[model samples]
Every structure is written in C-alpha cells, then in structure tokens.
Target: MKRISTLIAVATLALAGSSFAADRPVHLRGEVTAVGAGDFVVTDRKGTKTTIKLPEQAQVLDVSRSSQAAIQENSYLGIAAAPAPQGKVRAMGVMVFPEAARGLNEGHFPWDLGDRGTMTNATVAKVVKKASATELEMRFGGKAQQVVLDKDTVYGQFVPGKRELIVVGAKVLVIGASAADGATAANAVMVGRDGFLPPI
Candidate 1:
C-alpha cells in the first residue's frame, strides 16, 4: 500500500508539471498563407509553417507603420529590448501605443524574444536624438529606465482590429497558449496593416 501511494503522488506531480508547461505563452511572427474555418497557417521568416487555432473571441489588434519621428516626448510606448552596456537596454522593437492603450500593462517584464530579453510598456519622459541613435527616458510604476533605439530598430502602432484582419497575406505577431500536444491556440493576434509587418 505504501509503494502504491508513492506512485500515485509521483503521477500527480508529473501531470501538474505538464499542465503548467502547456500554459506557457508562445509567440509567433509570420505571414498568413492559408485561412480556414477556425484556424490559419503562418509561414515564418525562416520559411517554417505553423497552424494556429483562433478562438472566436480572441483579441486582435492592427499594427501599422510607425517611424522614429513619431516617437516624441511623452509618447506612451511598448519596447522590447535586450541588455546593453552602461546599465542600459537596446531596443529590439518599439510600439507606439494609441491613446486608448496608455497604461496598458505598464511595467518592465521579462520577454520571450531571448533569454535576457525584456518588455517595457511605459510613458516617455524625455527623448534625445544622437548622431546615430535615439535615446528614450521612460517612466512606469514610479520607476524610470532608459533604452536606446537605432536605425535597425523596427516600429509600429497598435489599433483596434477584428477577425477579418486575419486573412491571407497579412503579417502577424501571435501570442498563443501551447498545449501539451504541441498545438498552439491564439489568445491575441497583432496583424500588420497596409503592407506593414508587425515589428514586435
């Protein structure tokens, strides 16, 4: 009886671990190549294809082209960045949030872009343009941070969108939940608009 009970406890822990793994967020960036009744296929930049299940009520946002000129003082932004020298971070991509999105997820957090990547959703306190790059002083949750953006950094703006925007040929950044069986179901999708690809 003692051995049987230990085996059951071990099984329970294994099941719990699997459940937690399945709940991890999956991020995908690609172009829609096919659309079906309830799902779509995306071909990533590396030419790998993935089928993603889209729930009926998944949140969708349209990402439009944005430029460095649009990033001004006091602009609320979401920046994906990686560690840099001198206690600063280098911007991988920057998203200028719409007025309605101010304060949305406003804080610095770990991101999946890489092992040390981070995401900062904050309000710009100051902007400084250098000969080769731009620097932003951002504030969120009473904390201030600095990030550097260069010409290689991509930019976009988020707007409201619907399911219809998930059609073929559209580029998208998908945030989804992965299942134990390796399937992914989208929780939110950011679709690029007007031939612009989502930068983050």
Candidate 2:
C-alpha cells in the first residue's frame, strides 16, 4: 500500500509540474495600431491586445542588406535576436518563407516581393514586339504579350540562336516572388536581375 501511495504522489507531482509549465504564455502575431520605444501594444491574432517588447536595433535583421547597401538596407524589417529552432522564426524580416509568415501573419496580406518569398517559373515565348529596354512585347501563350518593368525600366534580353531576338523562341523561366500587396500583378515590385541573395 505504501509503495502504491508513493507512485501516486510521484505521478501527481508530475502532472502538477506540467500544469504549472502550461501557465506560461506565448505571443502571437496580430495587427499593430502604433509603434513606440521598447514595447508595442498589438492586437493578437486571437483579437486580444498584447504588448510585446522590442529588442535592440542590433538584434534586428536588416533584410535590405544587399550588394547595394544604400538600396537594399532600406528593405530590411529586422529579424529576431536569436533564430528559432529548426525552421521557426522569432522576429520578423528574417523571411524564410510561408513558415516564418505563418504565425505572425495571422491573416495579413503580402508585404512585398523578393523578401524571402516563393517564386514561379514563367517562360518568355516570343517577343510580340519591342517596347523599350525596360519593357517587353512578348507572347507567352498563343496570343500577343507585353511585359514591362516599373523599377529597372529594362527587360531581360536573353541571347538567341542567331539574333538578339529579344523574346522569340526564348524560354527563360522567371521566379515571380510574392507581390507587395496581392498575388496578382497589381502588387509586384520590380526587383532587378536574378542573382544569389544571402540567407537570413
């Protein structure tokens, strides 16, 4: 009887310990009304208002950091002081992918393209015509097509078999990163030529 009693006590204590640990809380991403010095009061995904403490600037990940410091530095939004275990993210801006955006996004829309997002392979079939160095008049499907750039003002001119055909018989797959606002062309930002971007 005493041995059984002791086992019960041990199991009871274990259960109590688990319950106590559960008392600890976690923060979820939500809408922010404003920003302040060290802490920001945000409406959590659950629709509850919670205050989160911001780390020092040095802890933030400047996503904008790129070959062109002046141009890319501005794009960074800052990541967590310490990266999450496995494939998790603690802060914002590190930009791993749908995983990083999962919790924090809460239901938010896309922020911008090329900021650690996915890409699609779109082929440039033929140049229906030429608009300029910045834009393209290509046919992707059986119909006429026109592609333009808002930032670089220069379309990628791929080499052809015998001519600078601009877009004829050229099959260059493009990685269409998430647009700034939506999934459609209405939100895509014109990021420069494709290259190796550093990891977060």
Candidate 3:
C-alpha cells in the first residue's frame, strides 16, 4: 500500500475540495488538486487535469491515469497544477449536496458546513474603513456581510484588489441551514458559519 499526501486544498468549506478520509495509500505522480471521499484530482505536466477515483472494491497499484501510464506521464512534464474535484461540473451543486457528497462531508476534519444553503450571482462589496489595516467586511445591497476566512485574522493586508479584499469580491454560496440569496441581503447579519466554498 502506497501513501498519498494528506493536504486540504480549499479554504474553509467542508466538502468543496478538502480531505474527507484516508483509507489506503493511493499514490499518483502529480500534484494533488482536491481531496474528497475516496477521490482526488491530478494534473499532468501538459496542463491536462485528470480526476482519479480511489479504489473501493479492488486495489489500485502503480496508480496513474492514462491509457498507458508511462506514456502519458512522460509526454506531460513540468506543468504546474492543483487538485480539484473529478467529474464535478459545478462545485457545490452535487458534490456537496448529494449522498456521495454527503459521504464526503462526514470525513475526518473540522468542517462544519451546516447546509446554510446557496446564494447565487451575489454582488461583492467591501466594508468601508478609515485605517490602512483593518478587518474586512462586505456590504451587499443594504446588508453587511462579514468576511469569514480560514486565516480568520489579519494584521495589515486589506488593500483593495489584493488577496484580502479580493475574496470579499468573489462570488460565494454560503453553506448553512438558513441559506439565502446573498445578492439581495440587506446588511451584515450573520448568515452562516465560517465554513464556505467560494464558487470562484
């Protein structure tokens, strides 16, 4: 049994693109993009991404994705890639909302995505600040939505257009029981937990 690197790829979401559980050491020869329930995505050196399903019934050996393993790996080399979901057309629709998705969300992790539900085409806005460095907040319509992040804290990286401010501008679907259309919300009322998978 070989081993795979256990790394969480997404931000704070439970079933978006993070670790669910580890049953066996399913090894592949590329950087892992996303880790899910018995599955993971890998991109070769040619910018070609393949999502490999982990073995459940039988053993997976010399685990590589190709018509023929060696030929595919050899042709594509030196390509930078990351792991994403395999066969997931959209991020949170089926992967995080169905049985297979449900099986994944229960994996060993601290993900608390409480089915707070979906928000689509939500406007991205930032909180107004008077200081150079301050906590970031988003204003959607008349409501303000506090930015919840995995880092969870910031010392001084709140410039607009940067990573800090950009996340607030990114579209999202807040996962919790009381799901709302984040696009029409009025103010910064707490909608769900910090657990979210940015739809970007």
Best by lDDT: 1
Q: Write the residue-wise lDDT of candidate 2 on 1-200 in tens digits.
A: 32333222221111212322423222133344444554444453356654444433101111122321111211211121122234322222222221122222112122222343221111233322235322222222234223332232211211111112112222211111122332211000111123212121
Task: Give the candidate number with the greatest TM-score.
Answer: 1
Question: 73 in model 2: Cα distance from truth in Å?
Answer: 28
Query: What TM-score, over all chains together, does every model reach?
Result: 0.84, 0.20, 0.18
Kindly list the per-residue Cα lDDT of model 1 for residues 1-200, writing each as its tens digit: 32333222221111212334647567788899999999999998899999999987566776788888898888888888899888788998888876555665678877756559888888999998899988999999999989999978988876567789999999988877778788888767888997677776
What TM value does model 3 have? 0.18
State residue 178's C-alpha deviation in candidate 1, in Å: 1.0
What lDDT score is found at residue 193 in candidate 3? 16
Clashing pairs in 1: none
**72, model 3: CA deviation in Å?**
43
Worst 10 residues of 3 by lDDT: 154-163
Please list the C-alpha lDDT of all candidates, in the order they appear: 0.77, 0.24, 0.23
**RMSD to native, candidate 2:** 23.5
Task: Put down candidate 3 lDDT per residue, 116-139, tens digits, no spaces.
Answer: 332211122442233432212323
